[model samples]
Target: MSKRDYYEVLGVAKGASERDIKKAYKKLAMKYHPDRAQGDKSLEEKFREVQEAYEILSDERKRAAYDQYGHAGVDPNRGGGAGAADFGDIFGDVFGDIFGGGRGRQSRARQGSDLRYNLEMSLEEAVRGKEVEIRVPTLVECDTCHGSGAKKGSSPTTCPTCKGNGQVQMRQGFFAVQQTCPTCSGKGKIISDPCNPCRGQGRVEKTKTLSVKVPPGVDTGDRIRLSGEGEAGEQGAPAGDLYVQVHVRDHHIFTRDGNNLYCEVPLGFTTAALGGEIEVPTLDGKVKLKITPETQTGKMFRLRGKGVKSVRSGAVGDLMCKVEIETPVNLSSKQKELLEEFEATCTGQGAKHRPKEKGFFDGVKQFFDDLKS
Candidate 1:
C-alpha cells in the first residue's frame, strides 16, 4: 500500500509551523489511541500512520530530507532515517502531553496528607473562646533514622533499571510509550537497609499533643487551620496542614443563627397582664428584660448586644426572646371560687375583656346564618 503524505495524514498544511503540526498530531493521537479505540484493528493502523507522519515532520533534519526525497528519504525500513531511540524520545514528549505522565525524572519526595479533626465545643465556650490541648494519633518523622528511610549510616541508592529517572520508555511500532519503572515503584531510589522504627516509610505512627486556640464566636462548621500539624512527610519533606473543624454542641437554653441568638421565655399570666421585669441569661451574665402591660403570647423582645460578636468582624448581634403566657393550673377550692367570682364579673364584659373570643363567635354565627339563608 502507498503511504499518505505526512501533511495529509495529520490534516495540516505542508508549510505549517511546528506548533500547528504538534496540535494537529495531538488531536489525531488522542482520537485514535489504542486505549481509546478499544480493540479496533483499523483504528490502530491509522494511529500508527499518524505517529509515523509526526515522527518525520516534527524533526527538522528528517522533515528536510523527506521534503526533498519523499518517503524513501526517511523510511526506517530503507535504513535512511534516524535511529529507533530518537523516535522513542520524540514520541515520549507527545504522549506525555496527552497523559500527565512525563518523560523526565520524577521526584521521590512525597508530601504528607492533610488531616481534619472535629473539635466539639459548648455554646458558652464557643461564644467566649478557649484554648485547649488536643491529642492526635498520626504519622511523624522516624527518630531512629531521622526520616531518611535508611539505617543510621546507609543511604538510598539510585534505581538501576530506570537510572533514577523513575520511568522507563518502550518502543511501540512507530511510537514511544513511557511508564513508571517497575523495579523501584517509580520512587527513583531504593532503600536497601530499611530503618528499624519505620521500616522503609521514613515515618512512624505516634500520638502528638497539640494546643489549639478556639476563637470567639466560631460556630459549627467553622475551621481553624494549624500549619505543619498534620501527618509528617516522607523522607523529611514539608508536612501537611491540620484543619480544626468546629462543632458546637446543642444549647439547652438558646439556638444560634449566624451571630443572633433566639430563646423561648415563659411568662406567668399575671406577670404578662400586669407587666413586670424578669431575669434572662446571656453569655456575659444575667440581665433584666421588662415586659409591657397587656402583652400576649408569642411576643418577641429584643435585647441589644446580648448575642455573639462575629469572629470575622466587630459587629454584635441582638438576642430575640419569644414570650409564651402560661395559664395557672391545679387550683385549690377557695382559689377556684375566687377565679369563678372574677369570671362572673367578666361574663358581661366579653367585648372589653375577651374581644378576640367575641369576634370569633360573631364570625361563626354570621357564617351559619348565611348558610341557612
Candidate 2:
C-alpha cells in the first residue's frame, strides 16, 4: 500500500512549529509504543509510520526535500527512519525538559545557593553610611577533608556502573536510553572512604563573621552584594554571593521619598501672623527657617541642599518643611483673656485678617440660601 502523508501521520499541520511537531510525535510515540502494543502489529506499524514522518519533518534539509517532492525526495527507509534520528535522541527529546535538558551527558555539580541577609538601619545611619560586622551561619568547606569529601589517605573511585562517564546506557528491546548513573548518583566518583568532618558531603555548617560597608543614601529595599560570601559549593565548587538587604526604619521627625526629605514643623500662633525665624531639623543639624508674614497653616518651605546626598547620582536633595499652626493648650487665665480680646478684634475684620475663613462662611451661606430659593 502507498504511504500516508507525513503531516497526516503525526496529526500536525504543514505550518506547525518544530516544538509542536516534536510534541505531537512524543504523544503518538508513547501511545503506540511497542511495550504498550501487546503483540498488535497494527499498533507497531503506526509507531513506525510516526517515526518515519518525524524523521523527515524534524530535519530542516530533509523536511524541505520531503515538502517539495513528497516522500520520494527523501526515499526514507523503514524502522529508525532515514537513520539520522538516533533512538537515544528520540527518547531524550521526548523527556528532556522533565529530566534536565539532555541524557547521556555528565551530571554537573550544583553551585552554592545565594543567600540574603536583612540588615536593619536607622534613617541617620542609612543617609551617612557605616561599616557593620555581621555573623552568618552557612555551609562551609570541611577543614578536615579540604572539600574533597574523601579521607586524607584515600581518594574517590570512578563509578563502576557508568565507568566514570557519569551516565549509563540501558537497552529496552530495540531502543537504548542513557541516563545518569544510579551507583554514583551522576557524580561519576564514589567516596568509598568518607570524610569524618562533613561525612561525604564535603561541606559543614559554620558561622562566618563578615564586615559589610553600607554606602550613604541607601534607602530601604537596597541590597549590597558580597562576592563569594555565601554557602560553599559541593566538592570544591565556587561559593555563591551574599546579598545584604537594607531596611530603613521610620524616622521620628522626617520622611524620605527618592532624594527629598519632608518634615512637619509646628508654627507658633504669633509666628504665623507676624513672620519670624524658627529652627528646623535636618540631616546636617538644625537650620534657621524664615516664615513669611500672614503665612497660613500647612504652608511648605523648601531648604535647598539640606536633604540627603544621593549615593548613585551624588546629587544633593532639598528639605521640605511644612508648618502647621499650633493652638495654645493649658492656657493661663491671662492668656485666655488675651486670646479672647484678639478674637474680638478680628471678628468684624475676617475679610482683611482671615480671608479664607471669611470666604468659607460666605460660600456656606449662599449654598443654604440657594436651597431655600
Candidate 3:
C-alpha cells in the first residue's frame, strides 16, 4: 500500500503548531497501541503508522522535508519497504508504561536528574533582586577516574554476554521478550578494576555552594532555572538544570497580591474627621497621602506605580492603602472633660451622623411597640 501523508496520518493540519502535532500523535498512539489492543495485527499496523507520522512531524528538519517533498524527502531507503522505524527511543518517551520501560531504554551515559532548591527571601529582597549563596548536595564527577569507572592504567571492556547490544532476548512460547542483560546491567561494558575514589559508580556525593541572581519582582512560587548546575551525569552525559523556587517571607507592613501591594494604615479619629496628610510607607520610601474630610474606615487610596513591577513583564502595579480609624485610649482629666462636652453636642444632632446607631435604636423601639400591641 502507498504511504499516507504525514499530516493525514496524524490527523493534524499542515500549519499545526509543534504542541498540536504532539498532542494529536499521543492520542492516536494511545488508541492503536498493540498492548492496548491485545494481539490485534491491524491495530499494530495503525500504531506503526502513527509512530511514523510523529517521527516525521516532531523533527524540524524532517518536518520541513516532508512538507516540501512528501515521503521521498525523508526516506533514504525509499522503495526498500518500511523498515522498523526508530520507535525504540520514541516509544520509550511516549508509551513507556506499555513497554515496561519507564523512560525508554536508559542510555549508558544518561543526563543527571533535575534538582529543586527552595530559597527564602525577605519582601525587600523579593521586590529588588538580590544575589544569594546556597548549599546544594548532589553527585559530582570523580576527579580521580575522570568520569570513567576504570582504573588509572586499565579501560572498560565490552561485555561477553548479549555481545554489546545492552539487551538480551528470551523466547517465551512464540513471543520474543527483550530484557536488560543481567551481567552487563545494560551498560554493554564491564570494568575489571574499579576506580579507588568513586568505587564503581563514577560519581561522588558532595555539597556545592552556588550564587544565584534573583531578578526584581519575583514572587513566591516563581522558579528560576540555572543551567548545568544540578547533579553531574555519569560517564560523559550532559548535566541537568537547577531550579530555585522563591518563597517570600511575610512582611509586617505590606501584603502582596501579584504585583500590587496592600497595606492597612491606621489613622487617628481626628484625622478621619478633619482631613490631614499622613506619611505612608512604600517600597520606595514614605509618601504623604491626604485623607478626605469625614472619611470612614476601610476607605482605600491608590498610589499608581508605587508597587512592584512584574518579573515576566516590566508593568508596574499600584499600591492600595486602606484607612483604619483608631479610637483614642487612656484619656487625661482635661481631655475627658473636653470629650464629654463634645459628646453632649453630638447627642443634640439626633444620630444623623451615626446612621447605623440610629437604625439599631429604631429597630429596638419597633420591637417594644409590637409587644405592647
Tens digits of per-residue lDDT for model 2 on 1-373? 8999999999999999986886687677768766679999999999778866876787787787677767656762321123245334556644664545644565555567767787888999999999999999999988888887998888888888887877777666655567668898878889999999899888999999999999999875566889989888878778877878666767899988767899999999899989999999998898999999988899999999988889889998999999999987999999999999988988779899888888999999999999999
Error of 1 at 77 (Å): 44
User: Would you estimate the TM-scores of all the predictions?
Assistant: 0.71, 0.71, 0.70
lDDT string for model 3 (61-164, tens) is 77876776677667634311122354344444445544555532443655676677878789999999999999999998888888787778887788788676
Write the residue-wise lDDT of candidate 1 on 198-271 in tens digits: 99889999999999999899876566889989888878877877878666777899988778999999999889
Model 3 residue 67 CA deviation in Å:
30
TM-score of candidate 3 to 2 decimals: 0.70
RMSD value for candidate 1: 19.8
Model 2 is weakest, by summed lDDT over 10 consecutive residues, at 76-85
Candidate 1, pairs of clashing residues: none
Lowest summed lDDT across 10 adjacent residues in model 3 is found at 78-87
Which candidate tops lDDT?
Answer: 1
